[model samples]
Target: MKINWGHLNHDSAVAVQSVLETEYNFRTTVTKLFLQKLTDEMHDHLEDVQFDICPLTKCFKISPATPEPVHAALKEIMSHHLPKYKEYTYQA
Candidate 1:
């Protein structure tokens, strides 16, 4: 799965990548071509974003504290990148 890290800085991107790779067993390829086209279309308003993936359940959770715009952007990105999975949002 390809993660949209355009809005994230180096450390944040690496952290996310580590979780996806180690926990979810996702193999990612980072190329110069991919980096060149990175889009910060979400405006980088969000500072801290979290993702929890459950491969068995085929669902992933995004941090509830996230702003609506960033949340929507994340949902869209996750949906596009992980079409087979479902989003698990906190209901409170």
Candidate 2:
């Protein structure tokens, strides 16, 4: 079974995910990441770097202009965004 990890909007975002996967086994081989909109809010967070989707996405024909700033913004969110739900704790 393959599961989607949502969309990645920038090259740096792809690089970051690749690093995470190679270094941490963050996802199963069957997992996939999809790219969606690169909004202004998302772009504002990036420091200043241009980006594009990976060949895989392009080969499949998914391409877009994702500026560096948006990548940075995504990174910031990944760096500081809180978990939607808390981990479970056991009481003795």
Candidate 3:
């Protein structure tokens, strides 16, 4: 998934980065710089960016131009981590 870790605290972001890399099989590193930029630019496009108190990253930005593999990865994440959350979304 194309996770943006900027909204989270430094340590939490690092933990998320580790999980995405090690457990989720993502090879690329998720750096603070990358996330900082994402936090800034992402808001320009998306209307709703939700944050939870779960100590993980606050937001999940699924780009309209999101690639196939990333989309698949997000699907896997939602299935495993967000089963209780609603699947349907409405754009305003």
Candidate 4:
């Protein structure tokens, strides 16, 4: 899945990506917990999945090889942190 956060400035897009990556590591609370949930539930399917940010396009891309369930889980997880960009998300 690709989520175009083109509406955000370069710095803001980077910040959001940083937050997600950081949260995934720490697993503190809220976003962290959700990210952990996705990691735990989709471990198998997520092996080849990648999360990348394109500063030029201001887009966040998830590997297309990810299973549909993983995609849905990602959408739900991202929606919490990026509600404003929901409309910009779509399958790649």
Candidate 5:
């Protein structure tokens, strides 16, 4: 019997299920009985990997931006003049 599998390298989520899925490929559909075979292999192979789903989200949150005085004035007028949800908290 030939087993078709993909290379499961450099996992970052570090989740046991994700790692096992990478290692098992389509085995879960082939046979649930032997999924443990691949899971055992994953247990021995977990390693550090850079995780970056939204790496930009971090920079955007941490970095500050200053608008020019003219732009700020326009924003102020538009925010106050425009219709907004009652739930909006920022000052116009």
Candidate 6:
């Protein structure tokens, strides 16, 4: 969540030493959020969406508190993009 939020607020002016990191785009994240399997209904993407009204009658939206799937997808993407395979010996 922190990483995603950082994407929304990227600051090249104050970067930490020598780290090679690019903030992921927020738009892509939104697209992924609504990606549904062929079996899923059109509204399945909205399963986690929460809406509410403030005291002033202004409408607002809140994302799901649980982002495990997003985190898992990130882990999967990182592993595939930057694989670290250990040396192995195969014995038959």
Task: Encode model 4's per-residue lDDT on 26-58: one tens digit a residue.
Answer: 223334435466766576664544454444443
Candidate maximizing lDDT: 4
TM-score of each: 0.42, 0.22, 0.28, 0.43, 0.18, 0.24
- Colliding pairs, model 2: 7-34, 45-73, 46-69, 46-72, 46-73, 49-68
In angstroms, the error of model 2 at 70 is: 0.1
Off by over 4 Å in 3: 1-61
Candidate 5 achieves a global lDDT of 0.28
Model 3, residue 61: C-alpha shift (Å): 7.8
> For model 6, how does the per-residue alpha-carbon lDDT over 5-74 read when each residue is reduced to its tens digit?
2121334544421122222333244335445321244344334432221212121122234244543443
Model 2 lDDT tens row, 9-52: 55697766664464233222112121233355643433333222
Off by over 4 Å in 5: 1-66, 85-92
Worst 10 residues of 5 by lDDT: 55-64
Mind giving the per-residue lDDT tens digits that candidate 5 earns over 1-92?
12222233444565445544533542332233223333554333222111111121111110012223422432343344433311222221
- Better lDDT candidate (3, 6): 3
* Superposition TM-score, candidate 2 onto the true structure: 0.22
Model 6, C-alpha of 81: deviation from truth (Å): 1.6
What tens-digit string does per-residue lDDT give for candidate 3 at 1-92? Answer: 23333433556767766645542322132232223434454434323322122224223334444544444544455555555422423221
Question: What C-alpha root-mean-square deviation, in Å, does candidate 3 show against the real structure?
Answer: 11.7
Q: Look at candidate 6 and tell me the lDDT of residue 10.
A: 32
Instruction: Candidate 3: give the clashing pairs.
Output: none
> For residues 1-92, what per-residue lDDT tens digits would candidate 1 score against the true structure?
22222222335766666545644443232122223333566445534445444433324466555667666766666566655444564222
**Candidate 4 residue 8 C-alpha distance from true site, Å:** 18
TM-score order of candidates, best first?
4, 1, 3, 6, 2, 5
Q: Each prediction's Cα lDDT score?
A: 0.46, 0.32, 0.38, 0.51, 0.28, 0.31
> Which residue runs does candidate 1 get wrong by more than 4 Å?
1-43, 53-58, 87-92
- Superior by TM-score: candidate 3 or candidate 6: 3
How many residue pairs clash in all the candidates, one count each?
0, 6, 0, 0, 0, 0
Q: Which scores better on TM-score, 1 or 3? A: 1
